[model samples]
Target: MSERMIRVKDIELCTESFGNPAHPAVLLIMGATASMLWWEEDFCRLLAEKGFFVIRYDNRDTGRSASYEPGRPGYTFEDMADDAIAVLDAYGVKKAHFAGMSMGGMLVQIIALRHPDRVQSISLVSTMYFGPGWEELPPMEAKVEAFFNSMGEMDWYDPQTLLRNAVDKWRILAGSKHPFDEERVTALAERDIGRALNYSSSFNHSYVTGGESYLGRYGEIQTPALVIHGTEDPIIPYVHGEALRDSIPVAELLTLEGIGHELPPAEWPAIIGGIAKYAAL
Candidate 1:
């Protein structure tokens, strides 16, 4: 069963943890503008059944963990990283294997850099070392704006409409070429609305080089790591996959051809397998 709490400045958080406590832990870090529900129940359970103590939760600004404070400066990724640390602390865990997707992937980089001892291994999926650029590849501003627009037109204030909007966004991000379970996404968005941020700070951090200067800090990470990305990812070019692999001394890269941004249901077996294999060592 999933549990919930208010943490780090009274922000609500929803948590789902299972499997043998004696087994190694796996902490899942989600992507930008995402909630814990997006983590998917089947995925989490699979990890648990695979002999892992799996932990997944909603970030402060997403899902049941949200609270709006306009005067509060949009939370920085650094602080967000700290919040992630707080989660581990709350659970009384000294360390665990971490697997992050997109923005969540960036958070692991920070943890591996700033709190190396707290991480057993790293798995980065569809994430960039830094922010996406207009020159390298145009930001998905239009699609994101369209998401906002569709919400407004559907009167997002209504819970059901907002859920539909959230589901649609997931479908689109999945490229809609693959089968997506709308019911799951809808429930995720439903829980997500309560944790929605009207003006939450996102992806804004002081970067001397890029958001994920983990490249420079790579040598500090003494743990094994893995980098996974889709070959057809338009948001972050496959070059990042190569870069992350090249930078981390003990990292391996897995490039999936034709896969889009989101992890599809069809690939869960391989996804869980890859992680279980790495965490074993």
Candidate 2:
């Protein structure tokens, strides 16, 4: 059944809880500035069907949850990890499987590192470990700054805009032959940003602040982790996934040769299968 109106540290996060509550829980964390809605209905249902009590919530600054300012120099990725942990505490959950995408993946890494006792396993998708040389990680300084700064929101009077946007991003991060499904891209844009502002200063600030960068600590994780990356992913190079796999003990890697940075809904079967395999362990 769907759950509603859960409180996580004063922020009213929208959560969807399904399947047996008695089963071990799986926390579904969305990417940076992305609403929990972007997790996609079919994928969430698939996880629920696997005897997992799934919980997907909006981050503090995204969706229906509270948005706090950096409120000092700024908030880092560690703060995001704390937010995820706080959600589990609010639910009174002792431990859970952690799944995240993009920045969400980084937060899950932090959560596993900081609160290892609370994690059963981890599944990270389209992510990177920002080891040393983060400031110099290719694409030139000017392009990198502009890339993070230009994630503006858009309206869908013409759906092609969304397709164009996805293609453009993939082109920059992946080579031209890298394929991305148009429908999934549109759905992601619709579910996550169809109603909210296109961009947030806080998200931009958080990115530049290096809150999501991980440097040389992947070997420290003791949990089972499944890292999935598209071979053609543009935004996060596939090398990031390989590095994570090499760092995390017992971590398995899934590389989709034809896919781009955006993993499509059509691939839910394979994605859910990978998650289920890890969750079973």
Evaluated with TM-score, which candidate comes out highest? 1
lDDT to native, each model: 0.71, 0.71
List model 2 lDDT by residue over 86-185, tens digit each: 7787677899999999878888888888899999999999887666554454332354456646655543345556546544553454334435455555
TM-score of each: 0.81, 0.80
Clashing pairs in 1: 12-65
CA error at residue 225 for candidate 1, angstroms: 1.3
Model 2: lDDT to the true structure: 0.71
Model 1: per-residue Cα lDDT over 1-281, one tens digit each: 45747477656566768777677889999987677666788899898999888888876556556544433435666777777778777777889999999888888888888788898999998877543332464354466557655543565346666566667777666643467777766666665675555413221222212333543466667888888887766566677776777778898888776766788877777778888888887
What ranges in model 1 sit over 4 Å off? 9-12, 70-74, 131-156, 175-177, 194-216
Query: How many clashing pairs does model 2 include?
Result: 4
